[model samples]
Target: MSATYDVYIKKLTTQELGYRKGRLMTGGYFYISKSAVGSFFKELDKYVLNDFLRLDFNDPLEPGNIIQASYVYHNDKYAKENGTRNEYRIYHNRAIAKHQLHFQPYEIVVFIKDGDDNYRIEHYTRNDKAYRILENIIEDSKIRGQHALLQLSEYNTLLNV
Candidate 1:
């Protein structure tokens, strides 16, 4: 409404989209980009750094029903010790299995932070009008190869962060 806003737009990769093994959705996780993760979230009080916390997210597609996702964190510190740097990733959920969220590879996944642990998630393909609008709004410079954390204002805002 005003000028600046907090938003995360990710152009999904094939691995990020997961595959359908004869109708079974397998091997996909909603990974939170560190570039986009600023102060959008409050203090990490809901879940521990290295723990599985059940997250019941609101899905507009399924009215009166919430999709579930396990919030998981793999700290960067572990990367130094031979683990991994996937600090913010949400996996092992029922959203895909239950068809609560529709998505595909190369489509963009949007995260508009309404509050801590609360966001309006949207998926858009390249052919979508909304995606075209976003294409004009999200500048080429802001994106890092495939994905980048982005923010837009009321005027289809586009600028380098």
Candidate 2:
């Protein structure tokens, strides 16, 4: 869709905060942060690498269309040995290929939590309003980049939802 918004608010992802150059992460798996995500993720087998929670997302970029993704939580012994925090990953190459949802280096992906197991995913460039806002937050609060959970909105309350 390649659309830019001076004020853009789309569906959310790993929602809030931002990711940087290494979003593709290791392998083709794309990851995000997990919060008070409710039963969908909460019930997932957190320590089981093979266990996954699924969601069907309505892509905001392409209205009225649904994209399916398989989400997995990594919090097992392997994760601890790797010194990684609890995180969520979506098998989204299908979404990327089918709907052109590419997360290039220094780009932004906003995952909006919709319901118990629903979300609105958004994409933006580093220079776009989304990235700039998160960038400012990162700079101002010294939030680490590249998959660091954005600890926003206690004092900030940046996005309405």
Candidate 3:
């Protein structure tokens, strides 16, 4: 049985502008200056909008950034994209049958900073369950011949031996 799931990105507007907790130094950073705060809000707005735009469409299984990695397992090999490789640690396990029945959702956070700092998009998996869900989603998609979207030449690279 095959099922479909929708992937969406939501806007996050809470800025963590605060204290440093340590043995000797306890300090707070405030967004007091109007210009600094205004500029920060503008960047946040753009970041959120970009995330929303990226989720406008549907994919059978979106492998997040893993699809860009060079994956080789057993007898299969998947070429890396953009000269980058993905590395992950499987902290827990879930039954593949149950995971296949329920698709997973991916949450990506984009941070924007200026001057010496630049913006970054961060991937967050809230829990081990969420991680399994996503792993199963990508696995199920591969089993159904959906790896073409990721440009993965073979399927064995993602299988658990």
Candidate 4:
């Protein structure tokens, strides 16, 4: 299994004293490899926006910049959004399974803005305590929404996976 990392952006808030504070915000999570991270940054530099600079994992990121990145492998195989509709129709040989055979990341290009006004992209691997804290924050925020909480069984399954 590939390593999963929790990605987030620090939202910056300006105070009356001309200082800025950063608040942790969810930018979604993904299961990706370290090499993929470098490739992603390369693409981000080549394409995306003209003003946006390429991320340097060795150094710090720039503030007030936007990162348009997505979970690499997550996609609806039969959807019309991309070219998958035709590909699935032509190659599908069996009934679609209810459960996914592999992990499907939350497919979305998480747009992260340096809210702290500091040039840094915060990321935590699965083993970090900060990862757990951010996960709790995400769960709490979701609970506050209209959706019902995940059942204990489902939560357990997620943890095991």
Top candidate (lDDT): 1
Ten-residue stretch with the least lDDT total in model 4: 85-94
lDDT of 3: 0.23
**lDDT string, candidate 1, 30-147, tens digits:** 7665444433422233233464556555685786666767666666454345555456666735564344245666677666665556666677888876776555545553545455
Instruction: Score every model by TM-score.
Output: 0.66, 0.57, 0.17, 0.23
List the candidates ranked by TM-score, beginning with the highest: 1, 2, 4, 3
Candidate 2 residue pairs in backbone clash = 11-112, 11-120, 12-111, 12-112, 12-120, 13-110, 13-111, 13-112
Each model's lDDT: 0.57, 0.50, 0.23, 0.27
Worst window of 10 by summed lDDT in candidate 1: 39-48
**RMSD to truth, every model:** 5.7, 9.0, 20.0, 19.6
Model 2 Cα displacement at 12 (Å)? 14
Taking the tens digit of each residue's C-alpha lDDT, what string does model 2 give over 75-153? 6644345645466667655564453335454565555555556766666676665577655544563223343233224
TM-score of 1: 0.66
Give the lDDT of residue 7 in candidate 2: 21
**For candidate 3, what's the RMSD?**
20.0
lDDT of 3 by residue, 1-161 (tens): 22211121121112211122512222111111212222322222221211111111111244222111111111111233332322111011121112321222232221222222222222334564334543454445433221111111121233231
Itemize residue pairs with steric clashes in candidate 1. Answer: none
